[model samples]
Target: MAEFIKIYPENPNDKEIHKVVEVLRKGGVIIYPSDTIYTLGCDITNYKAMERVAKIKKIKLEKNTFSIVCNDLSHLSDYTKPIETKTFKILKRSFPGPYTFVLPAVNNMPKAFKKRKTVGIRIPNNNITLEIIKQLGNPLVSTSIYDEDEVIEYTTDPELIYEKWERLVDVVVDGGYGGNIASTVVDLSETNPIVIREGKGSIEVL
Candidate 1:
C-alpha cells in the first residue's frame, strides 16, 4: 500500500514534504494534489519510475508526452529549447497558475523522450507540490489521473484516490480535496500560441 500523508495545503509540513521528496528521489511514483486535480508524478530523471507511470496509465511514453512540473521558471530552459522574448513574457504571465505550455523540447532529452519534438511544462500554484518539487531539485513528470468511472469524472477526494491507486504507487499525498478540472493546455511550439484545451486557466493572459 502507498504511504498516505496528509499535508496542510496552506502550510505544508517540511518533514512530510521531505518524505515525498525522498520517495521521488528514490524512484518512487506518487499521486499528489495540484491546483487543478490529483496527479500522478515521478522524478523526471527516473526512467524506471516513468515506465511504471506509463504502465499505470496504459500509455506508451514514446507515443505520449507527459507535462513536466517545475517549482519555478528557472529550470525551464534545461528541458526546452531557447525561449524567445515574447514566449518568455507569456510564460512569466501564465505560469505559477493552472496552465500547461507546450514548447519545443531540447534534443538531448531522456531516452524515452528522444522521439518527442515538443514538451509540456507547468509551474502549478499549489504550494505543497511546489515545495516538494523545490526540494527534489528537479522537475516531476506530471499526468492528470482520470477515473475509470464516468460519474466521478476526475477523482477529488485524497482518501478515495489512495484507495484506488495505493497498490500501484508508492505515496499518496493528501493535500485536501482537489479540483476535477485540469490545467489549460496551450501549444507554444508554433509561431502562434494556440489554446488546445480550455480548463481552469483563463486565456486572457495568453
Candidate 2:
C-alpha cells in the first residue's frame, strides 16, 4: 500500500513535504492534488517512473502526451519551443491558475514525448503542488488521476484516491478534496490558441 500523507492545501507542513520529495527523488510515483483534480506525477527525468505512470493510466506512452507541471514560466522555455509574442501575452495572463498550454516541445525534454514535437505545460496555482515541484527542483510529468466509471466521473476525495491507487502507486498526498473538473486545455500550436477542453479555467484570456 502507498503512504498516505495529509498536507494543508494552503500552508503545507515542510516535514511531510520532505517525505514526498524524497520518494520522488528516488523515482517513486505519487498521486497529488492540483488545482483541477488529483494528479499522478513523478520525476520527469526518471524514465522508469514515467513508464509506471503510463502503465497505471493504461495508455501507450508514445501515443499519449502528459503535461509537465513547472513551478513557473521560468522553467517553461527550457522544455518548450519559444512562444510567440501574442501567445506569450495570453499565457502570462492565464497561467498559475487552472490552464494548461500545449506548445512545441524542445529537444531537451524527456524521451516520453519522442514521437511528438509538442508538450503540454502547466503552472498550477495550488500551493501544495507548487511547493512539491519547487522543492524537487524540476518539473513533474503529470496526468489527472481518473477512472472510467460513468457514475463516478472523476475521483476527488483523497482517501478514496488512496484506496483506489495505493497498490499501483508509491504515495498519495491528500491536499483535501480536489475539483472534479480538469484544467482547461488551450493548445497554442497554431497561429491562434485553440480551446481543446473547457473545464475549470475561464475562456476570456484565450
Candidate 3:
C-alpha cells in the first residue's frame, strides 16, 4: 500500500519531505499534489520506476514523451536545449506557476525524452512538490492522476487517491486539495508558442 503523507500546503515539513525523496531515490513511484492537480511522479533517472508509472496510468505515449517537473529555470538547459531570448523572457514571466513548456530536448536527456527531441518542462508553484525536487536533486517525470471514467475524470481528493492507487504507487503526498484540472501545455519548440492543452492555467501570459 502507498504511504499517505499529509503535508502543509504552504510549508511542507522537511523530515516528511526527506522521506518522499528517499522513496524516489529507491526507485519508488509516488502520487503527489501539483499546482493544478494531483499527479503521479517518479525519479526521472529511474527507468523502472517510470515504467511502473506508465502501467499505473495504463497508457503509452506514442513518442514516449513525458512531462518532467523541475525546481527552477537553472536546470532547464540540462534537460532541454538553450531557449531563445524571447522564449526565455516569456517563460521567466509565466513559469513557477501552472505552465508546461514543451521545448527541444537536450541531446543527452533520459531515453524516453531524448529520442523525441522534445521535453515538457514544468516549474509548478506548489511548495511540497518543489521541495521534493530540490531534495532529490533531480527532476521528476509526472502526469495528472486520472481514471478511465470520464464521469469522475481526474482524482482530486487525496484520501480517495490513496484508496484507489495504494497498490499501484509508493506514496501519496496530501497537500490539501487539488483543482481536478491540468496545467496549460505550451509548445515553445517552434518560432511561436503553441497551446497544446488549456486547462487550469491562464493563457494571458502566452
Count of backbone clashes, every candidate in sequence: 0, 0, 0
Winner on TM-score (1 vs 3) = 1
TM-score of each: 0.98, 0.97, 0.95
List pairs with backbone clashes in candidate 3.
none
Worst 10 residues of 1 by lDDT: 59-68
Model 2 pairs in collision: none
Model 1: how large is the Cα RMSD against the reference? 0.8
Candidate 3's residue-wise lDDT over 96-168, tens digit each?
Answer: 9998999998898776564677888999999999999999999999987776676878878889889998988
> Which stretches of model 3 miss by more than 4 angstroms?
60-63
**Clash count, predicted structure 2:** 0
Using TM-score, give the best candidate's number.
Answer: 1
Query: Which runs in model 2 stand beyond 4 Å of their true positions?
Result: none
lDDT of 2 by residue, 42-61 (tens): 99988889889989888887
Name the Cα RMSD for model 2: 1.1
| TM-score, candidate number 1 | 0.98
lDDT of 1 at 56: 92
